[model samples]
Target: MTSKDPASPGHRPGADHSKHNHAGHDHSRGDHAGHNHGPSGEKHGPGDGHDHSHANFLGPNTEMIFALASGAALIIGVLIDNFVGAAPGWLPTALFLLAYFFGGFFTLREAIDNLRQKKFEIDTLMLVAAAGAAALGAFAEGALLLFLFSLGHALEHYAMGRAKKAIEALAELAPPTARVRRDGVTSEIPVEELEIGDTVIVRPNERLSADGFVILGNSAINQAPVTGESIPVDKAPVADPALARARPNSVLAESRVFAGTINGSGAIEIEVTRRSTESALAKVVKMVSEAETQKSPTQRFTEKFERIFVPAVLILAFVLLFAFVVIDEPFRDSFYRSMAVLVAASPCALAIATPSAVLSGVARAARGGVLVKGGAPLENLGSLTAIAFDKTGTLTEGKPRITDVVTASGVSEDELLRVTVAVEALSDHPLAQAIVTDGTARLNGAGIPAAGDLKSLTGRGVYATIGGETVWIGKAEMFGTDGIPALGQEMTTAVAQLREAGRTTMVVRQGGRDMGVIGLMDTPREAAKQALLKLKDIGITRMIMISGDNQKVADAIAKDVGLTEAWGDLMPEDKVEAIKKLRANEKVAMVGDGVNDAPAMASATVGIAMGAAGSDVALETADVALMADNLAHLPFAVDLSRKTRSIILQNTILSLGIVAVLVPATIMGMSIGAAVAVHEGSTLIVVFNALRLLALRNRYAESPVAAQA
Candidate 1:
């Protein structure tokens, strides 16, 4: 089915009414200027940037020709040494040095780079080890070491490109233009030119050009491009009663369509709802990038370890060299043996273990439709003791819709519906939309009357004069203590029944008398029940629902989701307290999307926000943000974390395993120092194995095909 907009549709009523003025803009600077320029300054395709970087080469094709010739010479020299057994010393030496120089140049440069950064890198150790091997008359082994290390470096670069491909793919999904309606006529315009209330016509086989609602006509849409679900959704006029009960399908007239999803076969028109930068897809990209930037606790510890590790290795190498020479050993043997020790203990495997796994884990989460902010958050997910979810949007769909209308005090249903819709028409809240939409439909063919002097009481109710009659509509509590007197047992009992069904009950008053009550509910997501059950099976110890909604609504949802504890009617700060209490028992994870929830999000051991069009403040504060609000991915992220941690431990133990056996072998003199050289070199080999995670593909196999396509 079509994907819904990432933002909570009914949470803020007037949010969609804001002006969107990006029409007729020149985005040539952003889109066109990314192309590469050739030597003569002509714009070229992607691969043409190589011209500028290699311009100072000895000549065109010179480097390529030299490389091939040098490689051939080295191959021939090795053959002669293996077969003839008596090549001239200089020939073997020269050929070996040439191969080392060409293949090892980048490694040497990287060594220098690490030195400049005031850190010791594995490159420097490899270089030292290779030099020592050559001095020990092991020319072939030294050359092979350089070649293998270079090969590993190239492979790592390619792996990084693959890891980043998802983001690059997402950036390319949106098309640049849209069809906008102006002055009663449709015209082709850049998406930037879209303005609020401007009807945009989306044709067959095109992406929904902006986040907007249907204003006219009908259509079906393909939302799999963004939602990771492969279903086509049907849309029609809002007046279709049968369609209204069909769970919205995320496919209906005037329903929000995200940026990347495609419009289906039927043609329909939509009103521009939000600016391009504010679209769901845009916010997901932002959140993913931020997550990549924030370092995890493990990453920080890795950095600290590297700083001390390099100096310690240097000291050990010097001490070994001094002890051998003072014992009357030859200076050459002593120095060379010292270098081998330095190479063997460089800690390359340790340095790479954390960040590489973290990078892969984040990418995996994105594939599952979750956007974890950084390595730290992903690591924290596994240790969570409790999870606090915001009730309005997190536990429920967050969009309230009219469920039932009842009349009392002899008021007709038609009269009650008409008055409610008229007053709610002046409001922009989700509850207001639910009431207005349902009221209008029930009125059926009744013409709307002009509403007068409509005044809204923030967070409460509304007062308006419609058809020359003053109407008051809001919660029973809104009627002041002395005004409505205490509630009768019957009224309270009725309200309790409505609340038990997870509905927000608001009383309707007319001419200072109670007419009846209306109930609205933010329906639960279809997949939530199954997803939460899966979480429990996978060892999620506790789940709690938290919301700014009233207590009755929160408890009803908590029961449905199988959460024994629920907290409602909380301000942002109060939610933080609830999270703090959960944390006192064990690690707590707070998940929310409102700016009001930012403080609690930060206070929790891990904060997971809804990144798909969620607020900037919430995205920034949350340790993780779901790029799409697909709850199934939440469990998937947790699974990836456990796997990543296992891989890291394996790499650590393997590296240390080789060291433990080899180090003592050298001290006992059972073998020459050459044996230590072989063992030490194996560490580099083991490190390359751990880096395989960087090349992992389809870790989240069910990720949206469009993310790759």
Candidate 2:
């Protein structure tokens, strides 16, 4: 059972995953570096100077600054005409030109590209109308409108692009080179060169360079990058049966391995089992790419609408032109007015409203270590009704450890521990590691011999000779109930409690006598509860946990995590059934960390997979993959989406609402320039509001009031 501790503090600053400590050995000067020519590509430069390649026209606030400058110039020009006498045409012309080229050049280029593609893009229309207005001597109006709109577009693009880069860059955690072992020799080679069945030695604390299986040694591995779980997994040799029985994708508990995960403490030698591109990181990239293909009803409708929107705008423009001509307005004035109407109705702001918001949201999510694969899943996340999680590896640590031990009359605690740890030392089970670790510490320090004979009994126990006495370490049931009283009620009650707490309790019997009971549980993360409370307070309801463990174990964890429902002993199909049941009425999100969770993840309204701990199948099936293993990320994602949706609505309403009030007034000739100015300025305001999601919150501080809404 995973026990969560919500109050844990942040990690050590500057503690990147790339930094590895090799247990008093500096592999940096080892033979591997001499063979690789790794430094051949290096070109050291002064760190003080800027890297020109990283710099582009895309400067922060450039768009907003251009918009403000152009808008102010237009308002100044109009004010000169309205209040002071008319300024010289050259003066206004010069100001307008400054704004036009600075603001319009980039936009015009994009507009031209769209036109070349035979697309009646809003940018093209806006450019044409703004230029036409300047030609008609409404220089100030044209320049201001052009600048503000262009700024919004640029800012939106930058924010969205940043998010895409973050997702694509996540796989960089895996080192490019791996140490391959062949014929008892070690050589460093690019990770991509690795193939199945090759033996690779991953030294202590180094990230696994590729996916493989443990061939020798043992260690604790922290796989938070793929599974998004922060806990480290203890690994042993494949000889341990309990670990052997673990699901194949669970990194083989002892033998199997993954790419891009770090060795927490010890070391392991693994045989390559998967190709580089088939690794967990690659699968997440593939899944995120595929999620873009899934569309929401709103998205589909909008795309279809955009297809016809341009032609419809043309018809409206023509109608306006004819009406003005029939009303006997001056030909030039009527023509420019008609163009303005088309520009105003081009849906430029509306076109950007949803995607810009979604993109910003996705990018913001990435900054906070959440990956929202597409607009559809992002939209679903905003309204999630129920979230179901697999108990092990999803809600809990998945690495079960020995928390308690009890012994019978003749066996002292130390003797029992020593015998148990000795037999377990011969195996690779997580429980075995716990016993071996705890027992080794006590034995070596106190000079007790680690046991031997160490023959494991299939599905039962280990047979070994300890201190000249034949010992059998396993369950009471492993030895048939001859005449011994069934475990006492208290023992049974204790076992029940352990199971309820999501523990896998194992009984250790030595030579037909009950030696002791060892309880193994996967404790929950420290941040789970606080994050859950934050989520609930923010409007989430009906949390659930689904697991392959027994009902007693599942129930215990559910109670602790504050889940509203718990289902245990579920197969993949069982999980899907649970999702189906939940989805019968409301949106459901399934969070999981194994291959078994794949189908159910796909079936849910929104599927979240732990990037650090999950297998390729599970990652591929999920709509959103959390780069960090903290479940708190789910609620953080939800918070971001909801906030983004709110921003979109605000921008949509603000833009359309201003147009509703100003468009009619402009048509009525009541200071149309000022009305247009307000409309344009408001559009810029709303666009900036949407971009604010880029600032990710690092702490669970009381959210600001603006975010609360």
Candidate 3:
């Protein structure tokens, strides 16, 4: 048997395809000659001659090269001193000088710059230690100190580069050129040159070059790179009123595709909705860059400690040299001990401890399609005790579906459904779509009567004229309230029963009579229950569901997802108030996916946006953005943050503990060479420890609760 194509309309048994003509599109005939397309269908070849040259002449590899050269020179100098004592002293001196200049030149320059700025950095301490070592006639030890210190710098630079490259890789995902169709003719053009509303054609297995909605064709899109979703999502034109209304650029919500996502083996045409620079991928790149610049709590503390510690070390070195001279100790020996003190007390390891871990954590999160705005949010995630979630899109799928239908005694189900569909077709609300979808499916190829004079009743529902009859489809109160047709006891009881079952119920009226009551529910997301359990396992004490949805629906979803509490029928301001109340007790994080939740999210200690891959509002407002719509990555983020925090603490203590042990050893006549080894060794250890966070992964996979549910 041939493998079934899930993207095809007929893949599901009993799916209605009469309205969609899938046979006419030829996916295999869209290949254009002389155009190189990547696996994701993004057109290859440089377009617009965009220059990517950077001004830093040293490049990312310069430090490593200098470090290797200095190390080799230091080794050669030591060999000469040990085995060729008869050789001229100048020979060993020249080699040592070469090593010092090559390895210590940058460090000295940075120290001088810091001095000019009235800042005492770890570089300053290293320079002072090396200078004193040289002055004390300990050229070999001084050269060794510079070489080891430079090697540490090189390794730190390399570690930071790896993290930076992870974010930079996003820029390479979008192709430079795109194939645009204008006036029915397709031609290759620079992606930057494509304007809004321009139609772009993407062939099979190509990456989308721009964010847009598909006006035609059907396909499956692999959005793993942008959203961290493992499963490929099916793409087709679907009438979603909420998406259309919220994102005006997206004409058919289901047909929307983002730049950098790989298209399946089906050709589709998309109308460009956003410019190349404004694409979701570009926003991610920008956000990641910004996040790297924001300092974490630990980083700030380290900086503050360095500001005081560096100066204190300098004063202590000076005092030691003065006291030794006053006691009639040899000036050279006194200087030697003072230099050792500088090396032992330098805060290089302490300074790097926090930033390295924070950067690694941020990079690791980015690779998994989660963006932590900066070190602050990354650090904050570890401290969050309670998390508030918006129900519609955070805990639930946000897509309403008709689940139950109750018709009046004389009215047939088909007649009730037909009248409902005809009126709901005029509405753009999520519930309206559910009614129309179920109604149309049950119609079985039967044509829906035209709806006329459609009027929306704000939040209540819709009013329309269908086949010359005044039909109303909305909340039960809309029909029974003052000056409107009152619903009978039978229909009211039916609506009440549906509501008690946690379904959003609406009454259908035709010609001023109650025809039926329809029940619609936005089901909980597949991963919601498992994600909640995982959050609890990760030490999240309080989980609350906050939503504008009715109380029963909110409570039902809260129970389904294992939340500790549920707050319902809240306005945007009410959500903010609820967050304030939660924050009064403990650190609270708010997770949501809409503009309405922005205030509440901002009010919480940390704001997390779900399904951020497509929404600019989520990208801009939330502190942390879970690129995908599901909560699979939420637990991972929390675990990673806690790990990062723990690692920073470990590094800080180890670094300080080394200085505490080594400084006293230096004063007690320990060799400067050993002091240098201990000091530089601690720096390396801290860096390598921080690097461990880069490899951290979720220890537990998402539970199978979602599948069971």
Candidate 4:
């Protein structure tokens, strides 16, 4: 039951196959940012001078320490040169050399590695610029450049490390062992040793071992850790097959449980259906782990930008270095100006701008229970122009519910509900149960007179003795044919109207007269309307519903939920076609149940799966999985991604603007020291700007665990 590799198993085909290289990272924290990829997708050979910035050559613990050491040495050298006139000139030179030694240690290692790999990176650019400064007798400027570059690099890593901590926490949710009950004996064992059909006992407050059916006992399960569902759901055994088959499209009682969900006070036993490592939690961890590898659109553009920008900057620096020779200017001045320009236009900030934002966005989304597959989907969700939703289990509650209560002229609404609840409370039919459930909820725990001697009229409805009176509740034809008087015109018209509106109608008769009509259907979720309104407010104007049900039912649900359009009688392939057509004109997102509508979802700009908590298929196939199955979270995801995109744009503007300003300033007498200070500041600024997404508040209410993130 090992988790699948995101890159190998679940990847959508035709994705990028670029040769992505990291600008620099501390591998212990697992950074795989996009940088240094060639447009031609060619592999590097030896001596290519490719930059692989290993900023922490000593170790993660000493990265900042080394930066401080470099600053200390440079400060001491400056003091000797300016304040101590009696100090030997060789003494300041020695101190500056020490500063270079401390700061250039990791840079030197990376430059050598890139030389061996035959590729160039930002590290090579920094080293070359520093050397040019030193060759022009600007030892102080070169030392300061090295010191600031190393220090800024260290600070950037420390800040991004804060965001990665949340991602690492998600991987730790599932336990490594399980208590197995076998041959009437219970024993603790490694989860890997448990096979399908094996019985696992879960005590109160214990996380599940694997995805499985609860075969015995019942308990409320807290699924917020894996599913993002704030409320705990009661788990029970599967219903009897015979009883479940009594009604068509009746909602089956939920019995399937997922790994990593905590059991409540009652101990339960589950039959393992999946290997522990292959559970949905494992796949979520895998997806988040490989997220950086799936480069965002901005990352791809950065890669291409660097492929040309690096070589061009190097050529420009060389031309500047020798340009003064042709005009008989001082060689030292020409060299110093050239070095400053090289430092100014290093593009170091550009290299880190997108990846930093993308990484933080991915971690933030996961913390909120939205599993964004990669940076590509995260950006795509923000850019989506339209969204199409699946109906069953998506827009609607996917089960029957009492929708309306129409009363006679003299009868009050409570009276109709009270009489209906009393009669249906004694019945076992699915429709009857729905009436009882909704009626009880409406009654707000009020006492109701009981019914007795309930009689079932096959193919019609039921009759029960209640409060010393007989009541008949059934279909429209059941009354007139069975010694029962037909309903008056108003009640009759009300029944017909409810039917036309795609609701299941139940006619209530008492005292030989029509009392009222109770209408039932798989009603829309309470949040569906508000969720759609939020989507519209967020600029998604073209909202649509696609369903396999009849046109009337689909349209009815769509109107109830505020969708802009509805399409019914759609097969799986029909849904795909609809998505492709919508995608042809605009960027579209297909939101569905995750498994059944995969093709359609894949056809759109981004595929969002609802309630993906326990389903591996949902996590693997869709671009984003809303683990809670709540439509309310959909808007949260979109809003977060939009915020992420804006932050990335801010970073790009600031990073590139610094370079733009510094280049001209350098050629007009900006010192190499000043250029390096501003260059390093821009790089750190880009990183901190991206980190702002980590704190972006989503629209949904956060649970205690999510609030901690």
lDDT of 3 by residue, 431-524 (tens): 8888888779988877678888999888787888977888887888787664677888999899889999898899888886789898888888
Per-residue error (Å), model 2, residue 699:
3.6
Candidate order by lDDT, decreasing, is 4, 3, 2, 1
Taking all chains together, the TM-score of candidate 2 against the true structure is 0.68
| Model 4 lDDT tens row, 562-653 | 99999999999999999989999999999988789989988989999988765667887899999876887888889889998998888888
Q: Please name the candidate that would achieve the greatest lDDT relative to the true structure.
A: 4
Global lDDT of model 4 = 0.76
How many residue pairs clash (N, CA or C atoms closer than 3 angstroms) in each of the candidate models, in the order given? 9, 26, 5, 9
Runs of candidate 3 with Cα error greater than 4 angstroms are 1-60, 183-185, 237-253, 325-328, 409-412, 426-430, 446-475, 478-487, 509-515, 698-709
lDDT of 2 by residue, 1-709 (tens): 0001111122111112123211111212210000000011110111111121122245434444555666666666566656766567567667777778766865675466455655555566678777777778777777766776655544443444344344444445677788998778889987767876678888888988776666578788866555444356677766643443344444444455677778866778876767766676555444443343344444454456655655665776677666654786776666666666655554444444555466556655654556677777887798887788887777787766666666656667787776677678778866678777767765666555567767766776667776676666555465545443466554566666666666677776655466767776676766666767777877878888888778877887788877788888888788899999899989988888736688888889988887443355545557787765567667778877777767767766765566566545444553324544464456446545656766645344323321221
lDDT of 1 by residue, 1-709 (tens): 0111222232121112122111111111111111111111211111212121122154323323333444555676688777766777578767878767865765676567456655455666778777877878877667766665554444343343344444434544566677887998878876656775567788888888776666566677765545444345565645542343243333332355667668877788776656666666555555554455455676566557656656766787788777664787776666666666665555554544555566566655654456677777777887776777777667677678788776775788887887788788988877888889878988896866777787877766777887676777877677665354444455566666787777788777766556677888887766566667766766788888888878887887788777757888988878888888889889888877646677888889988776343244655666776545556556656666666666656755665566555445443332333543454355444434434544344333344452342
- Evaluate residue 45 in candidate 1 and report its C-alpha lDDT on the 0 to 100 scale: 14
Per-residue lDDT of 495 in model 2: 64
TM-score of each: 0.72, 0.68, 0.84, 0.78
Compared with the true structure, all predictions reach lDDT values of 0.60, 0.61, 0.75, 0.76
Q: Cα deviation in Å at residue 607, candidate 4?
A: 1.5
| C-alpha lDDT of residue 322 in model 4 | 92
Q: CA shift at 312, candidate 3, in angstroms?
A: 1.5
